[model samples]
Target: MTLVLVRKLLRDVRWGLFAVCLLLFVFSAFWVKIAQRVTTEIAPFFNGVAAVSKINPKLFDEVIFKGPGKVSQAVLGGAEIRFDRPDDFLSVELLHPVVVIVTALWAVSRSSGAVAGEIDRGTMELLLSQPIPRNRLILAHLIVDAVTIPALVLSIVAGTQLGLALIGPFEVDYSVLQKLDLPPMVRLPAGPPVLEVHAARQWYAVVNLAALVFALSGTTMLVSALGRNRWRAVAAAGLIVIGMFVANVIGQLWDSAAFVRPVTVFYYYQPQKIWLKENWTVDLGEAWAGGSPMVEIPVMPVLIGVGAIGYLLALRVFDRRDLPAPL
Candidate 1:
C-alpha cells in the first residue's frame, strides 16, 4: 500500500520534479559561468585593491572593507570572499538567493501538499477510506522525498561540472597574488595563472543542500499534518523559511542579533566554511558557547535532527488528530 502510494505520488509530481531539476541544472550552470565572468571582470579591481593594500592597509580596513565587508560576509555565508579563488567564487554561486529559494520552494510545495493538500482537494477522505494506514501515507511522501531531494541537489553539482567543463579553468591575475604579499615560502605559479574549479570541493556542500531541503520537507510536512488547508500550510512554511533566512543574515551582520544563529536552520547551511576552511562539523556545545566571531555550526546533524523530529511529530499528529470533512 505504501509502495503504491509512493508510486502514485511520484507519478503525480513527475513533471514538476523534472521541470525543477532541469531549471536548477540550467540555472546552476549559468550561475557558474556568470561567476566566472564576474571574477574575470573584477580581476583588475581586486588587483588594484591589493596594490593599494600594500600602500595603506588601514585605508581599506577602516574605509572600504570595514562597513561594506559585513554586507558581503552576510550574503556569502560570513567569510572574507576571495574572488580569485575558484572555491570561494564558486561557493558564492551555490549560496545565491535563486538557488536557495528554488530548492526551498520545491520542499515547501511538495511537503505542504502531502497532507493538507489532500484534504484541500477532497482526496483525504477517499485515501483514508482505503485499508492504508495514515502513517503509511506520510511514509510514502518521505520515500518520495528520499528519492527526489538528492536528484535535485545532484543536478546542481552536475550543472556546476558542466559549466566548469565548458568554461575551462579560471584564470587568476598574477599581479593580485604578488601584491597581496604572500609569505616567502608560498610559491607562485610559473606558468599561466590558471586554477581549476575542482568539483570535489563541493561534495559536502551538496550534502549540506540535501540536508537543507530534507529539513524543510519535514518542517512543512509537520505543518501540513497540523493544518487542513494546503495554501495556509505553504504560507506558514514559506514564512518560516524566510524568517530563518533573514535571521541568519541579520546574525551575520549584527553582533547583538548573533544569538539567533544557534536557532535558525540556515545557520547550519554553511557551504562557504565547508569549501574554504574544510570545516565539516561543529560541537553543539561550542556552537552554544558562542565565543568565535564565526564558528562552524554542525550542519548534517542539526538538519537531520530537525527533519527527523518534524517527521516523527507529524506522524504522531496525523495518527491522533481528527480529520475534517472534505471541503
Candidate 2:
C-alpha cells in the first residue's frame, strides 16, 4: 500500500509546478535584498545617535528598532513606497500572499485528481478490483498529499534563501556579528542574518504556516472528493483560496468592519509580528512604527484547528463514496 501510494504521488509531482515555485523564490530573494539595503542604510544613522555616550560602531549596528522610517527615507527619501516599510528585514512579508497562492495551487493540483479524475479516466474500477480496501486507498491519497505539502514548502524556503545569498549584500560589521554571536562564516550581500527569528514571532509563524497549510490542503482534498470532475474540484479549491486572500485584504483595509475578518485565513497569518519583531528583534519602533493588532487575536488557533478537523471529515467522505461509472 505504501509503495502504491508513493508511486502514485511521484507520478503527479508536476515539473511545471516546481518551476513556478522556483521562479517565485527568485523574485522573493530580490525583494529581500532591496528591503535589507534600505534598512541597513538607515540603521546606521540611528546607531550613530545612540552611540553618543559610547562611540562604538557595533553599538549602533546592534540596536534594533520597530518601524520603517530609516529604510524608507534611504530608498524613497520621504516618498511612500506603498506597503514597503523601513523596518522590515525583507519586504517578503508584504508578498506573503504570493507564497500562499503558489502553495495553494500546488496543493489543489496534487489533490484534484485523487478521486474524481480517477473515476473519470476509468482507472477507478481497476483500483477497486485490487486487494486494497476503500478506506486504505483514501488514507494513502491523504498521506501522499500531506507529505507533498512540506516538500513544496522546503523548496520555496531553499529557493528564497539561495536567491538572497547570491544577490544581497555579503559583508556586515564584525562587531555587530560578535554582539549577536553570529559565526564569521555567515554572510549576506546587504542584509541582516538570513535565518532570524524572535522566540515569540518564530513560534507564531510556525503555528501560522502549519495552520494555513493544513487548512488549505484539507479544503482542497475535500473539494476533490466532492466535485464531479477534476476541473471542477480544482476550480472550487482555487476559488476558495483566492476568496480567503481577498477577504483578508478587505479586512485589513477596513479594520472596523467585522464581516471580512472572520472569513479570511490571512487574518491569522501575521508574518511581520512573527518574523520581524518576535524572531529577529529588528527594532519595530525605529524601523517600522505600526503595531499589528491582528497579533492579539485569540481566534487564530480555533480557525486552524477547525480546518484540520474539516480535512479529516473529508477523508471519511472520500472513503465511503462509490466511484462514478468508468469513462
Candidate 3:
C-alpha cells in the first residue's frame, strides 16, 4: 500500500519532472556553445602573449582571470572569482536562484496537492475511508519527496554534462600558448592538479543541490499539510520562497543586512563554494589586494537540521489536523 501510494505521487508530478528536465536540456544546449565561444576568443589574446615569452598558459590564465578587474575582480580588487574556471562555471549554472525557485515551485505544486489538492478534488474523503492511517499517508508523501526531488536536480546536472560533451573538451588554446608573451619568472605548474575534470571538482554540487531541494520540500510539505486548498498552499509556499530569496540576495550583496543570512535557507545553500571545495573570508591583510581570506564551514549539519525540523513540524501539524469535511 505504501509503495502504491508512492507510485501515485510519482504519477502526480510526472509532468513537473519532465518540465524541469526539458528546461535544463534547453539551457545546457545553449550554455555549452557560449562557453566554447568565449574560451576560443580569449585563447588568442593569451596566445599572442605566449609567443614572445616563456610564460605558461596556466600562469597567464590566473593573472587575467584572477587579476585585478579581470573576470570577477572589482576596481581595487576583491574576490578573485573566475567564472571561466570549470568549478565555478558548472556550480553557478544550475545552482542559480532561478533553478532553486523553479524546483521549489514544482515541489510546492506536488506537495500542495498532498492533502488540500485531494480535498479540492473530493478524493481525500474517499482515501481516508480506507484503513490507511493519516501518518502513513503523510509518510508516503515524504518518502516520495525523498525519491523525486533529487532525481529532478540530477537531471539538470546530467543534461549539462551531456551538452558539454557535444561541444568539446575545455582546454586552454595551444595557439595562445604558442604566441603568448609571458614573464620568464612565472613557474610552470608541476602537473595537472589531482582533480582536473570539472565534473570531479564540482561533485559536491550534487549533494548540495539535493539538500537544497529537500529543504524547499520540507517547507512545502508543511504548508500543504496546513492549507485549506492546493492553490492556497502554493501561494503560501511561493511567498515564502520569494521572501527568503530576497533576504538571501540582500544578505549576499549588502553587508548591512548580513544578519538576515542566518535566518534564510538560501544562506547556507552555497553550491559555488561547495563545488570549489573552500569558502573565502575577507583577506584582512589584502585590504588593498582585493582578495577574500579562505575559511571553511560544515555544510551538511545546518541544511539537514533545517529539513528535519520542517518535516517534523509538518508531521505534527498534519497528524493533529482534522480531515477535509466532505463537500
Candidate 4:
C-alpha cells in the first residue's frame, strides 16, 4: 500500500520532474558546447606548437604531451597542474553550477511538500485518515526524489560525453619532433605521447557529483520537514543551498569568512578538486586543506552520512507533528 502511494506521488510530481530534468540536460549540453568551442579555438595553437616542435628537435623528450598544459591554461583559464589530469577535464564539464543547483531545487520542492504542502492545501487531515503511516508517506516522497537526482546527474554526464565526441580527437602527436639524447635522459623513450579525451574519468567525476546532489537533496528535505508550510520549507532549503555555494565561492576571495566553509556542505563535496589534484582528504583538519597531506577520506560517505541524518530527523519531525485541519 505504501508502494502504491509512492507510485501515485511519483505521478503527481511528473511535471516538476520533467522540468528539472529538461533544464539540467539543456545546461549540460550548452556547457559542453562551450567547452568544445574553447577546445576548437585552441586546437590550432596546439597544432602550431606540434609543428614547431618538429624543428626544435629537443621537444620530443618533453612531458608536455602527457599533461594538461597550454590548452587548459590558455583556453579554459584553468590551472595546468590540476586540469592536466584526465578526470579533471571531465570534472570541469560535469560539475557545472546548473546541474548542482537545479538538482538541489528539485529535492527542495519535493521535500517541502512532504508534510507542509499537504497541510497548507488542507489535505493532510485526509491523508492521515488512510491506513498509511505518515513516516512511510514522507519516505516514499524522498525515495522518488532520490531516484530523480541521479537521473539529473546522468544528464550532465551525457552532455559532457556528447560534446567531447562531437569535437573529434583533440590530441597533439609529439612524435614528429627529433629525439633529444642528453646523458641519463636517454633512458626515456623519444616518442610523441598524445593527450586526448578519456571517457572513463567523466563517469568517475559523475559518481562524486551524484553524491553531492544527493547530499543537497537530503539536506533540503530536512529543512522541508522543519517548516510549518511549503513556502517556509522552500525558503529554508533554498537559502542554505545558496548560502553554502556562495560561501564556498567567496571563500576563495576572502580568508576571514573561511570558517563558514566547513560547516557548509560545499566544503566536503568537490570531486573535481579531488580528481584533479589527486588528493582525497576529508578530515579537513586545516581550512580547505588545499589538497595536501593525503587524508584518504572518501567524500561520498560523508555526504551520505549527512543525507541519512537529515532524512532520519525529517522522519522524526513529520511523525511527531500534528497535521492541520482541512478547510
Report clashes for each candidate as comma-separated counts. Answer: 0, 27, 14, 2
- Give me the runs in candidate 1 sitting further than 4 Å from their true place: 52-69, 172-192, 283-290, 293-297
Candidate 3 global CA lDDT score = 0.64
* Candidate 2 backbone clash number: 27
| Model 4 global lDDT (CA atoms, 0 to 1) | 0.63
Write down the TM-score of every candidate: 0.86, 0.65, 0.76, 0.76
- Return the clash pairs for model 4, or none: 68-84, 175-192
The lDDT leader among the candidates is 1
| Cα lDDT tens digits for candidate 3, 1-31 | 7788889878877877888768766775666
Model 1: clashing residue pairs? none
Angstrom error of the Cα, residue 218, model 2: value is 0.4
RMSD of each predicted structure: 4.8, 10.1, 6.5, 7.4
For candidate 3, the TM-score is 0.76
Q: lDDT by residue for model 2 over 104-124, one digit each (tens)? A: 677677667777677667787
Per-candidate local distance difference test: 0.81, 0.56, 0.64, 0.63
Candidates 1 and 4 compared: the better one by TM-score is 1
Question: TM-score of the candidate numbered 2?
Answer: 0.65
Model 3: lDDT of residue 262: 58
